[model samples]
Target: MGTVLITGMGRGIGRELARVLLRRGDRVIGTVRDERSISGEWSEFLASGQLRMLVLDVRDETAIRKAAAQVDEPIDVLVNNAGIIGPQRQSTLDMDFEGFLETLNINTLGPLRITHAFLPHLRRAKAGKIVTISSRMGSLSYAKADRIAYRASKAAVNKVMQGLAEDLRPEGIVAISVHPGWVRTDMGGTGADISVAESAAGLATLIDRVACEDSGGFFDWQGDRLPF
Candidate 1:
C-alpha cells in the first residue's frame, strides 16, 4: 500500500480522498489547521494505525517542513488540496487586496512550500507523485471575471505545478494539477454540481493512474486532459 499525504483533510474532498485511500489499504497522512477539526471517521483511522493526522496550516511553511520531518515513511504521493475562496469583496471595483494576498499565500505558494519540504521523502519512494487541486475557473481558455483573486491564484499554481513536473521528471516523480469539478462543500456551496464523494473518488482514481508521461499535465476529475 502506498503512503499518501493530503493537505486540508479536515473536511470536504480532502477528507473523502483520505477515506478512499485508507479503505484501499494505503496509509494516509492528513493535515488539519486545528487538532479539533478532524472528523470522527478520521479518528477511527488514526486509532487503527491506517492514518496519521498532522496539525498543519498549509500557509505556514515552517509547520509544513516540521510535519514533513515527522513522517517516518517514504511518501508515495503528495496531494495539495488546501485552498481558499478569497475575499468576500472580490470584485475588481472594490477588491480586498490583503485577502487576495492571503489567497495567494494559501492557494499558490502553499503547495510549493509543502512540496519542497517533502521532496526528499517522495524521491525515495518507488512512484512519487505530486497532485495539486486547481480549478477550471483558472483555465485561461475559460476566463471569467468573478472571484478574480481565487481564479488568479489557481492559474498561478497551475503554472507552478507545470514547472515542478518538468523539474521532477528526471527523478521519476510525476506532478500534475487536477480540476475537482464544482463539489459541494463549505467553499463549493450546496448548489454546486457534484458531491464531495463523487469528486474525491474520481480524483483518487485519477491520481492512482498518474504515470510518468502524465507529469506537467492538467486533467479533470475523470482523467480527461484539460487545456492550460
Candidate 2:
C-alpha cells in the first residue's frame, strides 16, 4: 500500500478520508492543528502505527517545511484538503476584505506551501500524485453569485495546481484538482446529497487511478472530468 499525506485531518472530509485510507491498508500521515483536535476514534490507528499525526496549520509555511523534514515516509499522494469557507457576511456589495484575504491565504496559498515543502519526498516515489480539493463553485463557466471569497480562492488554487502539474509532468508526478462533491460534512451541511463515507471512498478511488495522462485535469469525486 502507498503512503498518503493529507491536510486537515481533524474533522470532516479529511478525517473520513484518513479513516478510509487507513482501513484500506495505506499508511496515512495526517495533519491537524494539534493532538487534541483529532478525533478520539483515530487513536486505534495511531497506536497501530498506521496513522502518523503531525501538528500543522497549512497557512504556516515555516511549519509546513519543518513537518516535511520530519516525515520519514516517501509520500505517494499528497491531498490538500484543508480549507475554510469565508465569513457569511462576505458579498459583492458588502465585502469582508479581511476574511476574503484570510480565505485566500488558507485555501489557496496553504496548498502551495505544503506542496512545495513535500515535493522532494513526493519525487522519491516511483509515481507521485498531488490532489487538491477544490470546488465546482470555482468554475469560471458558472456565473452563480454567492460566497465570493470562497469561490475565488478555489478558482485561484485550481489554476495554481494546473501550473504545478505542468512543472512536475516531466518528473512523472500527476497533479490534479478534485471536487469532492457536496457531502454531509460541516462545510457541506446536513442537506447535502452525499455522505462523508461516499465522498471519501470515491475520492480515494479516483486518486488511486491518477496517472501522468491525467495531470493538469480537473475531476469530480466520481472520476468524471470537470470543466475548468
On residues 1-228, what C-alpha lDDT tens digit does candidate 2 reach at each position?
899999998999999999899988999999998878978888898899899989989889888989899987689999999999998767899898999999999999999999999999999998999999999999998788799999999999999999999999999999999999998999999999899999999999998888899999999999999999
Over 4 Å off, model 2 = none
TM-score (all chains, Cα) for each model: 0.98, 0.98
Against the unseen true structure, what C-alpha lDDT does each candidate score?
Answer: 0.93, 0.93
Residue pairs with clashing backbones, model 1: none
lDDT of candidate 2 at residue 37, scale 0 to 100: 93
- What ranges in model 1 sit over 4 Å off? none
